[model samples]
Target: MSHPKIANTDHDVIDVIRARWSPRAFDLSRPVSHDVQKQLFEAARWAPSSANEQPWQFIVADRFTSADGFAAMLAALNEGNQSWAQYAPVLVLAAARIEMEKSGRPNQHAWYDTGQAVSMLTIQATSMGLGLRQMAGFDRDKAQIGCRLEPPFEPVVIMALGYPGAPDALPNEKHRAGETQPRARRPIADFVRYV
Candidate 1:
């Protein structure tokens, strides 16, 4: 199947935005370069945060070529997700710490801010010819153990990042069909409520 064609522009901004999509299948054979990963993280670092707290932190486990700690982490993920997620070159555990402490009261905006950071990182990866899938189906306690996460740092999302792979390789027919589907979004009227 032919991939969607993107038009060239002075900066390719429009094409990048339009072509961005979550890809479940990844090319496990190809190891993502450190430079590329660094660039993606750099883009994430600049995302807006409440009060510039910049609370997001990432723990990356390179799963493509290395087996160290990879299996344990994969095991923590839901069995249904393991098939495709195992093929990703990198699995990032996005986390955030509760920053504000006023007489034992924890701030509520930290998670919200961290989510924004993840969105920025994913979009940057998409714009750079890479694919990312944010996942929440995992054993959080096991993941924290496998990823070596400490207290006060709560896991928000687990992300798989790598080059796109053939849809035929998916473990199930449903996933194969989903890989080729066009991007869908809720209608603007459904979301925008003018008070």
Candidate 2:
């Protein structure tokens, strides 16, 4: 069964931001189309970057669309992550350039900029009624080889995307429960400090 709607805390926030959460169980029967895929990346392409240096690249593989693409990427994931991520119809390896192409110097904020891009992508995906789970459980070295990434493009997170599947399909009961669990956030007092 599809998970029941998950509501946000009483605090006010954008509907999309509140609704966005990672889902491990994907309805692999529903394939993500190329057009929708383009839209997701378009959203990422517009995210802000330091000095306008967009340093992120996404290597996407769709099991439902491309032959052997998804299987190849899956091989790069850690054994544990492969268990659940295999169910997702789409897999993406996100990488960030460590140096700016224009300046030819190290870009200290490249990773941070890439995160901003991924955030935009997630919001766009959520708006389109799709779900994604981002995992850092892959070996970076192996991902570099699997993704065929060259120097300067360091792998970061691997994201799985597709339509949400029945929570009951998940092996762990906790994962099923998490699909409906009330989202939590740290209090501002816990992380924010007054100067």
Candidate 3:
């Protein structure tokens, strides 16, 4: 069954932008191929960054090729996330380098740039008929340790990536409810102000 939650927009938007929505229900049986994975990251690689620093770094692991690594990545997530995210065949830890590579100064825009990269990744995934969910509900400490992140680099978010699955495939009612519910966003006027 296909569940497409196309956005209700006020103006014209790109198909991929309209089509992108994070899904908690991920197909457990289907694994994203390495070639496809490269394409996703390649999108992120082209994302603009402050001073061309390209602070984003992704630690990727998939159940098929890196089972133990995938388990470790899953363990880094909080229990609630683990409950639902386990079904995703691929797990990713997005990180950012806090310090400027050459200057050794703090880069305030590191997180923002990393987010832009993830945005590109999300659009790419959506175009590929895949689902990407960014979860803030992960343990920072565990992610740092599990992913072997160092001082300059810090965990930003954990992402569950895979093909969208049935809402009933979720482990619990709450997640299923989240999956089947209509998507919502504040009216454009609520967040945007024209000068």
Candidate 4:
């Protein structure tokens, strides 16, 4: 089954940005290699951060290797997310340090920097021909327990990653149509304000 393409670029854009789209329909049969998984995190590692803190961290739970552990990972996500995420070969909980090391002060831009890190990871996944779906619907407390995350680190987003699967193959009726939906974004005029 062919993966869906939904990007609608208004102007010229890089191929990665043009082709990147989140997919819940993941091919369970195809496994992402450990090397490729490391490469993805390595991309996130290089992201710029406040005071060069580089606080982002990811805890990957692979269904391909550890089904029980993967179940725990899926349990961390909310009910709606669990319905589809269980099919993904990999799931990652993205987190960031809430404080800075040098002065032991709170880093106001930590979350923003962490987001940049995830953006890098996302684009890198695209370049590698993998699909990634970053989700906000997860239980932070459960993830903390499942991933054994300690303080000084926080869970921000859970991403379902793998090869794109046939949307028609999804067991849920609601998501069979998700992969084919048109991609839309607000015009720059709506969000960008020139001071």
Candidate 5:
């Protein structure tokens, strides 16, 4: 089962959109299959991007497949995230290719395109009854070193992916509280301006 953190929206949204919310607690016992992971990546593969650059890269490590790789990825997270993210079965580092492949010029939309890809991935995961938490709290230098990422590709977000776990499984009360809290967002009118 996925996290019960559904959005309380004034207007109706599709089930997947309403159901999508990041969760910190992940089921350590449940391992995502390679086939399912492939589907997620496939969804990301189709995201639209400027000039179709599709400038996103990902580094994935699963606890069940490679313990050393998982440990290395875990080390790249900040201490606060490591305390909880360690329980996730799958950890992914998303990156962006900062330069246009052909012209060797900087691609200004690289990060935005990467975010679009991740959003597609997130929706796919939610539809498949999985939950993921995208985190920006990581040591970029450490992640680059651990993944051996070179120029043109830089880390964007580190994500913890797996089945949702019980809130009590969280490492501390603070995180547990955050997990159980109602999801909130600004009203549509506040963020949207219509001419």
Candidate 6:
């Protein structure tokens, strides 16, 4: 598989946006530095939200120092995902609260707001030469127990972040290919409707 090439564009934002991809294989030997982790969270903190509710909450486990906690969280993941996810230096469980009062006593767009925060963090990680995979194939019940989550906060996505490793180290060739493939997107015409 060929490595994806970054397209040169006038807008600097496009460079960061285009470079982001989910890599399954990671260099487990090198742990993410505290400074970098703090930067990633700082980026998440600034993500736009409805009325600045900042509903997103993150539960992070440093694999090297918190092996037991990390292993417990990994136990809940699907076997396929667990194979690669276990190598990530940091496993972050992102959650958001459902704010009913904000939407006139109805369930507001908490999930949407949480997603925005996740996207921001992912991009920040990517820009810093790290790889990230946002996974949903995990046991929510076990995650809640392992992370000691409280009420009002629901588990949304589990993000694995670390420096990428060789594609050959992955579980299969398909995953390796996926790692190097250029990200595909729906044509703007398909999703955008202009009046």
lDDT of 6: 0.84
TM-scores for all candidates: the values are: 0.87, 0.93, 0.96, 0.95, 0.96, 0.89
The window of 10 residues in a row where model 2 has the poorest summed lDDT is: 1-10
Compose the digit string of candidate 3's lDDT tens values, residues 1-195.
Answer: 444477777889998888899898988888999999999999999999999999999999798898889998899888899999989989999999999998999999999999999999999999999999999998899889888889899999999999998899887899898876667788988998989
Taking all chains together, the TM-score of candidate 2 against the true structure is: 0.93
Candidate 1: residue pairs that collide: none
CA error at residue 168 for candidate 5, angstroms = 1.3
Q: Write the per-residue lDDT of candidate 1 for residues 1-195, one digit (tens) a residue.
A: 446423223343565566778888988677889899899889889988767777788988886555876777787889878888887888888888765543334647878888988888877888778899888999999888988888778888888899888888888888888897765566557877988
Show the colliding residue pairs in model 3: none
- Candidate 1 stretches with Cα past 4 Å from truth are 1-13, 101-105
lDDT tens digits, residue span 1-195, model 4: 433464676788898988899988988889999999999989998988888998888888998888887988899999888888888999998888898978889888878989999999999999998999999998889999998999889899999999988888777887888788777889988988988
Model 6 regions lying over 4 Å from their true place: 5-13, 100-107
By the lDDT metric, which is better: model 3 or model 5? 5
Q: What value does the lDDT take at residue 105 in candidate 1?
A: 41
Who is ahead in TM-score, 4 or 5? 5
Which tens-of-lDDT digit does each residue in 71-161 have in candidate 6? 8888878888888887788899999887554564433778899999999999899899998899999999988888988867888989888
Kindly list the per-residue Cα lDDT of model 5 for residues 1-195, writing each as its tens digit: 544478888998899999998989988888999999999999999999989999999899899999988998899999999999999999999999999998889999999999999999999999999999999999999999988899989999999999998889887889999887888888888989978
Arranged by lDDT with the best first, the candidates are 5, 3, 4, 2, 6, 1
The worst-scoring run of ten residues by lDDT in candidate 4 lies at: 1-10
* Per-model CA lDDT versus the true structure: 0.80, 0.88, 0.91, 0.89, 0.93, 0.84
After superposition on all C-alphas, the RMSD of every candidate to the true structure, in Å, is: 3.8, 2.1, 1.5, 1.9, 1.7, 2.8
